[model samples]
Target: MAPAQYLLAVRRLRADETTPVPTGAIAAELDRSPAAATEMADRLAERGLVEHEPYEGVVLTEEGDERADRLARTYEILCRFCRDVLCIDDYEAEASALVGTVSADVAERLAEVLLTDEKAPSP
Candidate 1:
């Protein structure tokens, strides 16, 4: 949702400059326009989260990668919860519902609880 989703896409698709993720690819992933992806990329560049080359592609900066990794992990945890708790069969359903709704802090807390619960010895 919003710019943060784009950051996650960039990190998941291309975390390194050696293999940049194309705007077209990002657009496809986000179900947005190429222009939309490029614009978001530009915005992210301004924040020093990514390097966007018009023709080359976009790659996440170190900070961007770290942030994106956190977002991606949060999403995965949410997805797992959806499947295991809510019994949602479609991941997209979970994604579309949870995207933008959850905050980083909430996500991290949820992750800690879920992971801790998962690791608790089943007595």
Candidate 2:
């Protein structure tokens, strides 16, 4: 899946745990248009990330849960790196910029160091 789509899937799956999120909810949360949200939902459903319950709501499958967990962890590590080590004031922007470019090896190394160094100042 494309990175944006992957992030959308993760966000939708996360919403499911907290509330019965409709497609519109996803769109609003992501600041995407309704059509885009519908399209994203269709793609995610095709990939088994979610199941459509007709008029009910969407629910995340086990595969979606695993993927979202991994993505969330990666995002958290990037946020820590940008805010703690790099001393970036705009952590969200910096972290988003790094998410797609950072290699898994580098992310792991950063995660290791960040995990070990708990005293780093929070942004």
Candidate 3:
């Protein structure tokens, strides 16, 4: 799973990433097992993406926050593309499901198209 999921959960639980967010809460938010959440949290910490507290929870490291923010932006762009461009009914959900799966190149291309479309004069 993408580390951004954990970051998003923490942000959803509370905006501030400095505060500890319990692993159980994360598991519940992501609908995964506690062990899985812990495992991912540990992996994130190893990558300097997050700080996993043994019993308490995890905190988003500075790098984690930046990644999360970037992911958020990408998600929004994807949502707009799916909705306004592709006419998908469940754009937000589709975008949310694509958080980590979409390639950066694809995301950039989508963003470019979105920008271009927005700038284009209406037909």
Candidate 4:
């Protein structure tokens, strides 16, 4: 999936925390223009990452949570590699831009290395 789409999915999951995440709450958290969060939420629902109920907050489906968790883990691993091995502190933002283009094999390889490298800096 595209990085922005993944981010939107993750954001929606975040919004579905203990307290029901209001559309306005998501909008504030994402700092998006008015209704942008709702629109993104709609797209996420269409993708099965989130489900919206009339007059109620959004919730993540089991599949949605799993996918979001996987994306988040992959992104974290990417950031660690870009920072620890590549000596880049701005890895989070850079990795965010590159995550979409990174191949699954490459991400898995990077994740393996990051998991084994005890000294790898974690974000």
Question: Which candidate leads in TM-score?
Answer: 3
Full candidate order by TM-score, most accurate first: 3, 1, 2, 4
Per-candidate TM equals 0.79, 0.71, 0.80, 0.69
Q: Give each model's whole-structure lDDT.
A: 0.75, 0.63, 0.77, 0.63
For model 3, the local distance difference test gives 0.77
Question: Taking the tens digit of each residue's C-alpha lDDT, what string does model 3 give over 29-120?
Answer: 88999999999889988999888889988888888877777777767777878888889999987887887788656777777766576642
Please list the residue runs of candidate 3 whose C-alpha ends up more than 4 Å from where it truly belongs after superposition: 103-105, 115-123
Clashing pairs in 3: none
lDDT tens digits by residue: candidate 1, 13-104? 77555688999999999899999999989999999988888987888888887777666766777776676666788975575457557876
* lDDT (Cα, 0-100) at 33 in candidate 4: 49
- Report the Cα lDDT for candidate 2: 0.63
Cα deviation at 41, candidate 1, in Å, is 0.6
Across 50-76, the per-residue lDDT of candidate 2 in tens digits comes to 765544445666787666555555666
Tens-digit lDDT string for candidate 4 (1-123): 342544444555463454445666666654664377677767878888777664565676677666665566567677878887788979987777776577656777776665575642332
Q: Kindly give the number of clashing pairs for every candidate.
A: 0, 0, 0, 0
> Which candidate wins on lDDT?
3
Report per-prediction Cα RMSD to one decimal.
4.2, 4.3, 4.3, 3.9
